[model samples]
Target: MTQSPAPLPPPKQRRHLREAASLTQAQVAERMGVTGETVHAWESGRTTPRGRRREAYAKLLASLTKADMVTNTQEAAPPPQVTVCLNKKPNPRRAVSAPTPAPITPTPITPAPITSAPITSTTRTPATRTPASTSAPVAVAAHGPVPASETEPAPLTPLTPAQAFDALYAFCAPALVRQTYLLSGRRELARESVEQAFQLAWQRWPEVAVDRDPAGWVRATAYEYALSPWHRFRPRYRHPEPPPADASDRALLDVLLTLPAPYRRTLLLYDGVGLDLPETAAETEASTPAAANRLLNAREAVAARLPELANPTALHRRLAELASAERLRAAEPTTVRAGSERRARFWTRAAVAFTVAIIGATALTVRTAPTRYEPPVPPGETVQGIPPRSAPGTLSDAELKLRAKLRSGILHGPQRLIPLAE
Candidate 1:
């Protein structure tokens, strides 16, 4: 019966071993004849290797573990120091009478433990070694005490939020501005994009500070802002910025602008920024093959127009030179941080005001509204209580006589006359 296979280390230990060996997942995958994703899955415990592959991976991890052990052991031991003594010819009588002194052995000092207290400069005095006897010279080999600063480095103080934000801005803003210029071909817009990206970073410092790659976060933001199609609609950016003064530079910028935005970004990230294909793909939000295709297309377009830049080295150099020549500058970190805070305050106040206005309108409507519902009255119908007036016709004999009497009696004004009966 075959022996059971050896158990593998835990998933976390497997990843740590690989990192200790300074090997990337892709590198390990290539050696193991598997896809990078497979190695990633193995490390992440999503899947396990089987058969010969399992045996091979176990062996690889074992070797890495042994290597790490050896390295740690070597680092822990202090180096030995040797002192040689030179002596002149001794008198025979004196040499015989004097006893040979025992060699001095220096005691090793244990390294100091690190603490969180602030580091201060202090003078260190070296301990002098004493020999057993002064009559005869003796060579001594001993380990010197390691310097406190070297053995136990002071722990770094954690940066405050503002300090961290400023540091990140100072480190990335200048280079990002240059990169944005290549993406958009507008110096002013490039500056604006970098500033806007920093402002956004300041607004979300907590998220950005804890990110694995804060520079990449800001870079992606700047690129997205710089290459926004909405910029085309802005009156200031509707017309293209003036081309570079040099004819070659002008041709290069024109060619870069001709490519699709995605292709241009991929090319710049891969070639100009010195990022590998995988990283460029991740940043551009595309697959490795798609990013490669875009890069190829972009390079071909540029090479067709400017054949001198056909080589990637030459192209990268040209891109760098082109960007450096432009007068791109980023706003101060303090300014960007203040602006972000101001913008946030403005929006917050506006929201509060809008809510208050809505509440007031609701209250006013409630107060003025008719509480009780009243049914409207319908139109009145004609009543038949009074008979309709008779139309003009020949009067009866009695009616005519009465009318003539009334007309004759009431002629004088103030007299009250009674109606006469016919």
Candidate 2:
């Protein structure tokens, strides 16, 4: 009795056949008149093709694989050669002409035969050769590849100002806020710091979008602002309830809080935020070596608090787990409403700052101004106007009459006096 062939696993068979035929899942689906997801489902072992669909799929796979094999074979084969006979036929349009005799006409033009010079060989090295014409020397770069700094960076992703802001906020806000929260140990401060950073980013999106590390820029800015002393006096500082901690976490938090701020930030950034020592150092305003030392010292301190964490491997593993949990918890999506509120708050703060500056300038101007001065004079005394210098002469009767008439006019009249009220 003939034995039946063992059936192949669906996913393996599908993947092998598609890859062998150099086809994508989508391409296979297109041939089968099914959605790409359906093909993915079959190949991922999530669902199986059945009945008529299964038969049709098998047939399609067989045909495509066969066609691919035939195409490859044809491409790999060499071209055929064709031979030509030189003496096959001459055209009847014109037969080759016989050479005519160049007879006695050349007798007068005969001359002595010229002597031939001996041939000689000389070797030339290509490197030392100079061009026949004057030319500038060509410089060859010794370096294998141009350094990244020497190359112009590609343009930033083509995004409208609004789209850039939205995308950056959506991608980085949660992570930034989370990192800030780990630093400040307060949700409200974290939220405020992240919002402020994003506000600045939105206002300067052109610069920020082209930055090599825009998210890093945002995080560093948020961190600096969160640590500012002015936040102590904010009336609206509402601290949200801390995330629930198990016994181990409570112990970890106790140890973390007891450490110095620098050590704590280094450890958090290294493990919690998955930043390397150089990056953590830059963010915390410390040198890389200093940051490394701080991390080691902080780890030892934590080990003292929890003896079981003394082992480096165990410590790293536990920290990694904690960081994973923190990320998962902090992954809440930032909404449009939140962004709008942040923008409004930013403008409000800006206006307040501008008004304060204006008021300060005005006060300073008033304070520094020179006081007006009037020459001291006795209460009852008046300084008379200097009399005009004139040539000494006796005036005629007509001139004297004119002067007297001018003195009687309104401009030259005596001033009226009014009595003060008792």
Candidate 3:
């Protein structure tokens, strides 16, 4: 029978051992004749090594573990000691000249009477002040020299919420306005977008202040606002803005605008802003490969339009120049903050009014509505009478004869007897 192979440590342990041995995944993969991704998979426990590779990886891990143990032991070992001659018998011969003199007793002095001086309020002075004269030196001597630590400058106090917000706005607003201008060809819209973004940031300063990248937060907001589809429908933005005065700038801007919105944004983030691929993908909310494709397509389109911008460096430079050539200034931080507050109040009031209106309408409907259901009366129908009436026809012969006799005789016999009907 064949001998059984040794069991390997857990994946986490294997990774720890490799790292403790100062070996990267790539280095381990190279040694193991496997790919770095394979090693990563193994370390991450996503997949396990198998067959001969497993055995070899196990041996490598064991060796690393042993080496790590040895290193730890060495580090934990005590330091070596050295002997000193001062503790030896050298003092017996060298210091035998005379017995050591006894230390003299210190003389006791009476304490002076303490005098309490009236406290006076004085204005503060600078930490480092020059001595006015020899007479001023008395105060210094009385206090003794200030310690080096005390003379050192104090640490800075943390910034207040408003100050911090203002600083962040001042630092990022100008560049953000320029970036927004590139995103949206309209300078006025660009300025408005940036101011709006900062206003939002100020409104959410608590969340934004704690965020890792406040500028990135603001940039994303501004970009979203600048590229909003609603802007096209607005009357102010219905008409296209005037092109740049410079011919080259106009041509470049036109080309940039021709590309699709996502592709343009991805290209600007990657090339214009100099963000790496992953960061660009993150900001644009696209996969790395997708962002890469967008960037490639955008660059190709621009190059097709203006061959001079084929080089990425030239493209970036041209984009920067194009954005800078346009004068886009952002609103003041105070103005933005004030606008945000005012907008917030207006919306809040509008919401309250809407809620009140809804409640009143509901109350009115409930009050006016019928309390009980009433079935509607059915439509009228014709009913037969007790005796049915017959249809009329021609008169009888006898009746017709009598009618004719009366009409013929009535003119002469009205005064005489009228009993002639038989």
Q: Which candidate is the best by TM-score?
A: 1
Model 1 spans > 4 angstroms off: 1-71, 74-154, 238-240, 375-422
Q: Cα lDDT of all candidates, in order?
A: 0.74, 0.60, 0.73
TM-score of each: 0.60, 0.43, 0.58
Q: Which of the two candidates, 2 or 3, achieves a greater TM-score against the reference?
A: 3
Candidate 3: segments with Cα more than 4 A from true spot: 1-140, 145-155, 378-422
Q: Is candidate 2 or candidate 3 better by lDDT?
A: 3
Tens-place lDDT digits, model 2, residues 77-176: 6433222235567566864443322111111111111111000011111111121222222222444444646543354445456665665665566556
Model 1 steric clash total: 0
Top-down TM-score ranking: 1, 3, 2
RMSD, every candidate, angstroms:
12.5, 30.3, 18.8
**Taking the candidates one at a time, how many backbone clashes does each contain?**
0, 0, 0
Where model 2 places Cα greater than 4 Å from the true spot, the runs are 1-157, 235-243, 311-313, 323-372, 376-422
For candidate 1, list the clashing residue pairs, or say none: none
- Model 1: what TM-score? 0.60
Give lDDT tens digits, candidate 1, residues 42-140. Answer: 775656888889999999999999998976675466534333334565555753333343333333221111111000112122222343343443333
Q: Give the TM-score of candidate 3.
A: 0.58
lDDT of 3 by residue, 1-422 (tens): 98677688887798668657656565787798854445655765656877898899888988998898876776566533222344456544553332222222222211111111011111111112222222221112233545757644465566678877877776567777777787888889888998889888888888888765676788899999999998878998888988899999999989988999999899888777656576678889999999999999999999999999999989987887887787777788888889999988998999999999999999999999999999999999878776777897788999899789778777564587466745
Residue range with the least summed lDDT across 10 consecutive positions in model 2: 111-120
